[model samples]
Target chain A: MQETPRIRMLLGLADDALIHGHRLSEWTGHAPTLEEELALANIALDLIGQARALYQATGLPEDDLAYLRDPHQFRNVLIAELPNGDFAFTIARLLLVATAADLAWRDAATSDDSDLPAIAAMARNEIAYHIRHAADWLIRLGDGTEESHRRSQNALDALWPYTGELTVGIDRSAWLGAIEAVLERATLTHPADGWMQGGGRDGRHTEHLGHLLAEMQILPRSHPGATW
Target chain B: MTNTPLWEVFVRARNGLAHKHVGSVHAADATMALQAARDVYTRRGEGLSLWVVPSNAIVASDPTDREMLFEPTGSKIYRHPTFYEVPEEVGHM
Candidate 1:
């Protein structure tokens, strides 16, 4: 409820995980295969778990923060709110965000000996797995077939602009290098950097966040204090 | 579904423990099989290590040979380690 520099940082982390996890959850019943269905769901759960911990660290009720926030109140980066395009697109998106999340959480865990650091320590391990899963898929799709290569490359280029917002407290060069190595291994060309889009960090966001929140918040808003 | 082969999974609960057969996962390669096994079988820290083998690679005993192959072994009680005298210090093998 109260805004502080530290709380805003926590919100940024929580919102990114929450929105990205929500987007991933959309693939629950529709992933390409049974193994991928389970894999994607597990990754989504890990991300939501990370969001829960970060929100809890803010000393606000995590549910209230999640379900009661307005569209403008969300601080998740723009790339996270984008729709899951195709299988290759989702994997590409995962590769990008998971890499950033892994680095960000690692830095946070090592930054201080506080409650946020403890949450970050646990989150860092889970996100390490996310990074590996995404990287593995990126390679498979990027190098697998002619169609897959085109799709994977397109996904990276499309999502590249929104990544500019992720570097507020993150190391841009480290993130870029890590991503570049994976892209190189995947045999996917790196998109040229250009006019980087931003905003969600300062509460400005794409139109998608409103629709996402509308669906995500409806049950809580409609029912108020009711619980099963 | 397109040539993604099935692999049988085995997971070790901890160091010094055997990797018991867990289940199967479908993957295009050995590396993906391991990742799939980790995702499907070991979500709750249930394993210290994992192994995935192509399901087709495993050779299984024929059910019809059970009596011929295993019946004699059932009668061979002398193979049991119970024949050895245990020193008290050795304790609980």
Candidate 2:
């Protein structure tokens, strides 16, 4: 049987959340401050929760989708799987992705598909905070001391090229406008439009994804059928 | 930085109730304090409302003065509501 567009879309959303949530979880003990550690962990939990809901909607066990799939089989955006280089880099990626997610889920909340609207409704709320938190950090880091300002600008420049891939089918203007507003408030100059990268949606990913999956799937693959 | 101020967090578990102290978190400002409080103290839906007050803003009495502040009230039994018994029919009182 062929996969329905609905299932494919749901899988994409689930993969995005799961991969990004895994990245965010890496900051658990490593955030700059104790408060930030908790904040990141909470956001990670929210994303993972969204992924689980999205997966469950497809009538598949979330663990199987998360832990059993090979890297090439996953449907997340390349940006979601990118290595978090530094605090500023993570914030930059997070701000971009959260903005897209906030907009995506906002529309999904009204989806006609089964379970998606309800799942999206709850996810929309969590992603709203994720946007707020990321935007807050963006502003603070972008407008803060010289070192912070430089790092924030550099992070944006490095990550900006990957953002074009995020708006392939979705309405790009709204996401662009929202991001521009945040950038303006942060006193940061937007990077010039340049070459864009794609292919994560097509099952093509960067080298980092393989390493991420290796760590994420190690236990599950090593001990198949093992129950906690 | 370590010098960031700490804010005490309080949560009102439900409507028509007072906020009770839950914990504290370090924040550079009140907005971040509230955000941290929400992230740290309310993850389990344990609050209907939140209050974040800077630790420095609080004027707590010295613990050493507890005897002078509270012990004297203990012997003032007349101030107690249990001093007088209600009739058996007044079950609630």
Candidate 3:
């Protein structure tokens, strides 16, 4: 059976939020400080909340959608699944994705579709907080102690390549034009010099995503019908 | 201990009547200081606004100095009501 355009759109939204949320959750007990640990957990919750709304919009049970699918069935772009390397790397990813998601939602808030716009509005508010939290870290790490500064720069460089997939601007279903248009407007007009790195959309992900997915999907994949 | 700087956090929640001291977190600098404060104190939608100030910026008196600092007028009888009568109609005290 064919899925509706709205369903397809909703699935993409849910997939992105779920995968990212899962990735963030891995940092729960591993952060360098108690404060950072809590911050990462809170962001994870925000993404999960976004995923729940998108799943509801698509008429799918959020739990089933998150846990029932095999790896290949997932459509989250590689950036969402890339491993969290270090505190600096995680902060870099947070800044990049939060900025990207904020831009995407800014356009989505004005989507031609009724329900998606409302969902996007709520997501936009949450994204604002995410952006603020990550941006502060970005600035501190970017301009802090010599070691921190080096780590932040390295993190930005490492994560830069995966960010390309975030603004692919194409949807298989033609119904997503509004979202695409919004993305174009929201994407950073001129990313700071030398920050444009590409190649995450065509499924040629970095080695990191494979390992991350293996560990992340194991619990659900091993016991397909199990509930926690 | 001497090398570490202290920070004080003030949070204003959405439903709160005033900005109150929530808790504090330590960081190497002012920017990280504020970020740490947010992460430490506002995990559950507990803050709409936040302020972080270096603890050293505040001036405080030692508790040991309390008597000399505040005892000058303690014995002024006029400062306390020695006796008073409440009318029966004054109601609950």
Candidate 1 chain A, poorest ten consecutive residues by summed lDDT: A107-116
- Tens digits of per-residue lDDT, candidate 2, B1-93, equal 898899999999999999999989998888888988998888899999999998989998999999999999988888878877789998884
At residue A150, give the lDDT of candidate 3.
76
User: What are the models' TM-scores?
Assistant: 0.92, 0.95, 0.75
RMSD of each: 2.3, 1.5, 6.3
Among all candidates shown, the one with the greatest TM-score: 2
Show where candidate 1 strays beyond 4 Å: B72-93
Chain A, candidate 1, TM-score of: 0.97
DockQ of each: 0.68, 0.78, 0.46
Per-residue lDDT of model 1, residues A115-151, tens digit only: 7788887887888888899998899889989999999
Docking class of 1: medium
Which 10-residue window in model 1 chain B sums to the lowest lDDT? Answer: B75-84
lDDT of 3 by residue, A1-228 (tens): 245766766776677788888889998888777767877888898898999888877766766677665555566777787777888778767766776777677678888975779888788878887777776666666656787777767776676556666666533133123223322433312123355444433334456656666776678788876776
| Superposition error at A93 for model 1 (Å) | 1.1
Q: Which ten residues in a row have the lowest lDDT in candidate 3 chain A?
A: A182-191
Off by over 4 Å in 3: A1-3, A170-228, B1-4, B13-16, B66-93
Predicted candidate 2 versus true structure: per-residue lDDT over A65-173, tens digit per residue: 8899888888899999998889988988999999998878877878788898899888888888998988988898898889988999998898888888787667789
lDDT of 3 at A57: 77
By TM-score, the candidates rank as: 2, 1, 3
